[model samples]
Target chain A: MSAFDWLPELLERFKADYVLIHEDAAVTTVGRARVLELDAEDWGRAAGVAAKFNLRWAGGWADQLTDQLGGDKLQINACLLHQGDVLLLRTRVPVTTPVLPSHTLHYPGADRMERHTQDMYGVVFSDHPDPRRWARHHAWGENEYPLRAEFPRMGTRGDMPARTDDNYRFLQAQGAGLYEIPVGPVHAGIIEPGHFRFTAVGEQVLNLEQRLGYVHKGIEKIAVGRDAVGAARLAGRVSGDSTVAFTWAACMAMEQAAGVEVPLRANYLRAIMAERERVANHLGDIGAICNDVGFAFAFYQFSRLREDWQRLSREVFGHRLLMDCVVPGGVARDIDAAAVAQLRAAFAPMKREMRELMPILYDNPSLEDRLITTGFLSESLARLLGATGYVGKASNCDLDARRDLAYSPYDRFKIKVHVFQDGDVLARMRVRADEILISLDLIDELLAGLPNGDVRAEWPMPAAGSEGLGIVEGWRGETLVYVRFAEDGKIARLFARDPSWFTWPALEQLIHGNIVPDFPVCNKSVNGSYSGHDL
Target chain B: MLRLFNKIRKIGVVTEPVMPGRDPAFEEIGEQLHARVGELFSGSLAIREVDAGSCNGCELEVHALNNPYYGIERFGVHFVASPRHADMLLVTGPVSKHMEAALKRTYDATPDPKLVLAMGDCGADGGEFGCSYASCGGVSKVIPVDGVVRGCPPTPLELMKAILALIEKRQGG
Candidate 1:
């Protein structure tokens, strides 16, 4: 029997109805996720069952449905994971008075996600722990829900509003000698904006409450009514660094709904692009983490490597950050023999430089001393937060989507998923470093094994009311893109779950008891995406 | 440590001598930038970056200026931590509703005669995430923009060129 056979039976015991989501098993590639529709009460109870069965809280989102789509209902979907299996529990509440039981008591990471869903869809969780405005921050009217089908993509207002939202209540620490440190929506570095409220006792942090949504450009709201290709382009911008992953996931969702078999060679190109994206990001991050710790030497070196890598990306893929490369049916750019040769040549030096740099990092006492025990997230805490990618891998979560979910191109090779039990800054760095090497190897394999055929597979758009889910392991972690196609191939709904959503909360948890100064290195270790999370 | 030094020595002088520009006009702008900085802001130009709302593609390219290859610091262009210390603002993204106040405050905080060069297509006119309830269309909608460097996210060279061109336009005019 499959590993998740017990999951359905356990949920059934709780009296929740289930619908097999991936009916087109014959055309399944991105359809491996098990999606179930349950009664609102049972969906909440499923969280308790998930806790009991040790299923990880993957993510949750709320969608606004129009009356034409059966009835005006607020659909809530929560994803739970056990091993490699993805179980998405869904339920609908009347839009007039949408309410559901909260999962925050069981899953601590569901706190912000639920608030985000509520902010966008105007749904309420009965026992939500912290219900302050998240993405709702003064943009729309108090009662206005932007995600509602009735709300215009461009709001009723003609002009941007003024900001008076200085008072986002952050839980403060009691007792003497506890002070609050307010960081930014506009950070010091060239990074995306997000405010961090740190409650500290002298040098050590008591807690970190993040106030993001500063970068919310109404991406999800604007996504509605766009064709699959247009929405996929917008999806690429959901997180710039993980553009390949986001676009690939969006395309996979559309392709799955359309039942189009993507050319085998296209998958290889996608994998190569994805692996390059990972390596490029890891290279930049390695340097940034070092830079934050008063280590400028590695910073310049890694930045140089990343620039060179991105230059090659521009030469090969037409965008430095590789934006708009992965399209709806297949890829936008195709690699020639010469470009392939250029890619191989470009990768050799960077790979060698990385290998040489790792030994020095390991040998350096100052770095080791700082990174070894700092910002620790226990394996249990990581699973509790549903952390994925290097964050999860560093904490010994040990699951990689490429290996666990087993997609095309990756399915051709045995993926090397790195796991470290340290759960510290060094372990996180180790994960990035090791993953770079693994990605380089994967790219090499992709180049060697690439099939000779057409890159783009043209197909008719699926009929209206079609929906699919796309999940990919990005540079940061798991990226989920869900798409529902409307009439004339327009998007009825689109949700791109940045890896940062799950891991951002983990940063808040991990920073506890860490010195205020150590927060930078610790933060850099996680390096959760603000743009991705805000969108 | 010794190995690091050896590696450093081997990779010595990686910075390009001249920052390459896209065209003759940009090249001319680049050639005149250092001297223009001398005339306007003494010898150094400090830029404070405000990310109103972005996918972070512009930030990546902007941060590349600090890289050994770009070596923007060599031209006495520093990215300051605060707007008070900045002579110019290299802003990215369309103005998101939440960040409008932050961007305005950043612009106000900078001393007068400060240049504001909007970077990327989003910064120019809210490229994809257009004028909506959330986005304010462009940087100019919130604060006065001296000039704009437009691309989905302009390359480092293009961004650099735009900055130089912006300086020349303001001071030369």
Candidate 2:
């Protein structure tokens, strides 16, 4: 049976008083998902019911309600997934006493997100497992919540010394041979900064704790008053590698809120861009993962191919990473017949080269030794954490927004979602490799049947309080963007939830029992986006 | 291994010669640097990169430097793991407040005669996330930058020219 048919019956069975079962008319003119709003008191119970019904926790966020709206309160938003249908659950707490029951008790993946909401909006999640700050690292004063309407965009300049986060209390292990190995907020490589505290006995890691938010640049705060197009540009940079995905999602959200209809050609072009991005990232990652395992040959070959791929992207799209390419109502650029032919011609050779490299990676005993069974995450833990994308797919969670939650151009194509039962470094690598092949095929199909027409639409200003959600499958995984328009045609709030939110916490879980030296490859396998997480 | 060798033979050497023709201003600076330093800085420059708070777009271009296309190692410029062993520091992002102290510490660790190059528009002028509650503005706000490469993400060629300019400045001083 379809998810929509059985969801309401299941909710009724679990004693859920559904306040409203409304269509998502605010975002799309057609094909809106069923948005279920529930009572605040049954929030935690609803979470338990959903978990029991086998729904995955997609993501959660908080928005501060202004007093001008006649209520000084904080609205909490949580999303759950059962097959293709998305169920959005919201609850509110008074600004004076902003506290709600935590969902982490039912959905373990909600832990970090709850803490993040608590840190940014000062809404306390009572009975939260670990209450210590998640995203707030003394970037602002203890009492100052940055997401509040009263908080200024340009924060106060302080004379406080650097290294203010020296006193964060990490969970300690108490044994004779136990010691902690603290790594970066500043790493050795050309990567974003994040602190990892590994409590270990000798080389075997006993426990792993990550302290991110070192790269938080007030993205959500700066997006407060931007126009739909302007806010999309900001969203594009949420994670540079996932620029196309984030921008497309943001634009989709904005278009939905404004009730704009993107042309068929524009949707097709978006698919091509998104697929190219997927291939590029997968190539780079396959190479990087090999490099981490001390295999330089695969690294060099893959890097060369990735470089060629990006150069082609620059020639076709305006940017190498396709930054700021997707604007509200459509895309910024369109491909002609010649560009389409060039793209179609380039795929076969690239695939040939990739096929040539695959055997070496699969047969190399040393590489296999490093990757197989290393940093293994069981399927149970993966589901509990709601880890989507390749990380979840590697662990056998078969939910791809492209296939399961198909939308627009993607719905027209037959997508091959790759999933592997063994949740190891090897499994993740294989998933990426399979995805690269699949994305190449998708690109060929998309370009071969390129749609005709204008690429953009005239987007009318959305009414104030109009809200919409945009969901897309990024290279990393599923990306969700929620956009609400203000009265003056400015953005009320734009929350872009990257897939890294669910996967970063999984990195901590998988690192257990693995040796310290295996940390690099294990970490690279997941390759969580620090900027996406921080934002 | 035999298959790999055959594939390698078929591909041959794909590295292209340095064009040095994209930006005239950068080309002129490159010429000046070449005249000033000659082979002195060639084959000896070690760089350490720190991402203050960039979107990883700059980091992707930075990684491309080591690829076969740019092959920065041919010019003796290689990325080092530690700041202590480096002759220059490549900083990206619009220095976030939380990372202010860490960037300062990385700079201090890089030893004397260290050159810092701020990359991308964000590193130079805090691209989108400007001076805010969480950000302290560009790399210059947290540490002194000797040169700046301005692009949303400067192409690898632009980055190469910027490196050459830094070498010239060091030698001229």
Predictions' DockQ, in order: 0.79, 0.74
Q: How would you encode candidate 2's per-residue C-alpha lDDT over A1-535 as one tens digit per residue?
A: 5557877576575565343323443422212555555556667777877888888888888887675754887888888777688777776778888877789999989998888888889988878888998888877877878998888877654645446588899997798988999999888788889999999999999899999998998898999999988899999999999999999998888887788889988999999999999999999999999999889888889999998999899999978889888888888878888999999999899989989889978988899899999999999999999888999999999889998878889989999988999999999999999999999999999998888999989879888877888999999999989887888889988889999998988999999999999999999999999999898
Question: Each candidate's TM vs. the true structure?
Answer: 0.96, 0.95
Per-residue lDDT of model 2, residues B1-173, tens digit only: 78878877887776654444534553454355445444765447789999999988999999998887667676567799899998889999999888888889899999997899999999998988877888887998888889999998999888988888777777678
- Candidate 1 lDDT, B63-117, residue by residue in tens: 8888988777766688999999998998888889989988988989999879999
Kindly report the docking quality category of candidate 1. Answer: medium
What level of docking quality does candidate 2 show? Answer: medium
| DockQ of candidate 1, scored on C-alphas against the true complex (2 decimals) | 0.79
Restricted to chain B, the TM-score per model reads 0.91, 0.87
Error of 1 at A257 (Å): 1.2
- Tens-digit lDDT track of model 1 for A1-535: 4756776566555554342333333432226667666678655667887787787787788776776765888889887777778777778899998988899889988988899888888888988888888887777787888888888878877684756467677786688888898898878888899899998898999989988999999998999889878998999998788999999999998888878899989999999999999999999999999998998889998998998899889989999999999998889978999998888886678788987888988888988888898999999999888889999999998888898877887888999988999899999999999999999988988887788898999968688877788888899988888888888888888888988888888899899989999999999999999889888
After the best TM-score superposition of candidate 1, give how far the Cα of residue A70 lies from its true spot, in angstroms.
1.6
Q: What is the lDDT of residue A167 in candidate 2?
A: 84
| TM-score per candidate for chain A alone | 0.95, 0.96
